[model samples]
Target: MQTSVTFKNIDPSDHLKSYVQDKLNRFDRFLDNPAEASVVLSVEKFRHIAEVNITGDRLKINGREETNDMYSAIDMVMDKLEKQIKKNKEKIRERRGSRGAVKASPMVGFADTLAEEDAEGEIVVTTIDYKPMDAEEAVMQLDLIDDSFLVFTNAKTDEVNVVYRRNDGHYGLIQPIR
Candidate 1:
């Protein structure tokens, strides 16, 4: 990753520049292609702000943090950037994996191998922010995504819920029993 740091309303410090470079270097592994990062550090009265913008491959990520100190703001913004990088990488990997995978046909002898693999299935755990939303709004959100199902926290009941598109062209909702 190539990084450039800009200081606003404060004297440029070599220490701060080096710190940002070191932090940006860690994200290079998450990116398959080379990336460019632009960082801005500014101070307004008592508020210190750090902002970073990164562009690589076909994606862009931005993170901003405000704190009483510049270093803390930089650290917080870096944490946010790391999360964004990991999420982007995971999405790319998922797209590639889903497209390349081929299922064995039942007519072929390989069906037995596939059955054994299914018996010892690989479990994947994905963490999503279950933001509270009403059922109608969640249904609308599901329409915007390519996925058939969505998991969300219900605003009215304050419980985890799922909304899925049924095979019959209707939608179904799932809620846990009280």
Candidate 2:
């Protein structure tokens, strides 16, 4: 792991730098690839803030904590980052299990195996139980959830429709044309 520490509104101290490096080294076992961490330690009046941003293979994590003591702030932020790393690793493991692992077949060439892997990424199928509701009701229901898109049966036409949030901050409705 590579780490860079920055101090803002506080004098740089070797003790603080070494302390953070040691704490970050403890997370090496949780990572598969070399990771770079950027840590910022700042002071605002009586508040001491510590923030760490870690970037590695397929992962980007950030943690920030503020307290009266700089040491405590560093410890708290490291704990938060560790928890997030563990949680993200578990989620990756779960996703891998859901998607069958790729194994090179005995008779298949290396190129063939690569093509198989690419095909696997083409489409993902998931089952969703859509509820029946009107278009207006669907829009209202979508607002109450965090999903980017929702599927609901249009009450008036009894047809399936999708209500989604657009990048332009507008709602889009997808209905099949008869």
Candidate 3:
């Protein structure tokens, strides 16, 4: 897998870089294409923070941890990522029994919801064409742009899906059931 390490508010060292790369390489066995992994190491006051993002095929997993030592933070983050991948694998296995079976449509209803508080001056609106693509490509486009979230139609199911960057420096996918 292609790995890139970035250090913020800390001096870049070959030793630290190699350490992170070595730790992230353990996830290679879980991925098919492996794609690329981005690791960010930063220091906040007394805490050492490590964040890892790996995107491959239809999977995008991210994990972050803060500890007194950078190496320990990296280890914790990798452990969290492993747990997420295992959980996702289990979910897929559970659904294998329903393979090729058409599922019933879910009921939909709308309830009155409060509007979001806008603190940034007046309302601003922008429009863009909705394109159909897979979740992986949608995330790649989000990273390439300045937006925090992207909405696109899923190429496989033709359903609307959203890919957004989370506060913990990870990506979140939202798929609406119809």
Model 2 TM-score, all chains together: 0.56
Q: Candidate 3, which ten residues in sequence have the lowest lDDT sum?
A: 103-112
- Residue pairs in clash, model 2: none
Q: Residue 165 of model 3: what lDDT?
A: 93
After TM-score superposition, what is the CA distance of residue 38 in candidate 3 from its true location, in Å?
0.9
In order, candidate lDDTs are 0.81, 0.83, 0.76
Please tell me which predicted candidate would have the highest TM-score against the true structure: 1
Q: Which stretches of candidate 3 lie over 4 Å from their true place?
A: 100-178
Candidate 3 structure quality by residue, lDDT tens digits, 8-122: 9999999999887887778777665656889999999999999998888577888989999998998899889889877875566446524624321121111123444556785
- Better lDDT candidate (1, 2): 2
Q: Candidate 1 lDDT, tens digit per residue, 76-133?
A: 9999999988888778765654564332122311112322333346744445555678
Q: In model 1, where do residues sit more than 4 Å from their true spots?
A: 103-178
TM-score, cand. 3 vs. native:
0.53
lDDT of 1 at 50: 99
Q: Where in model 2 is the C-alpha error above 4 Å? A: 101-178
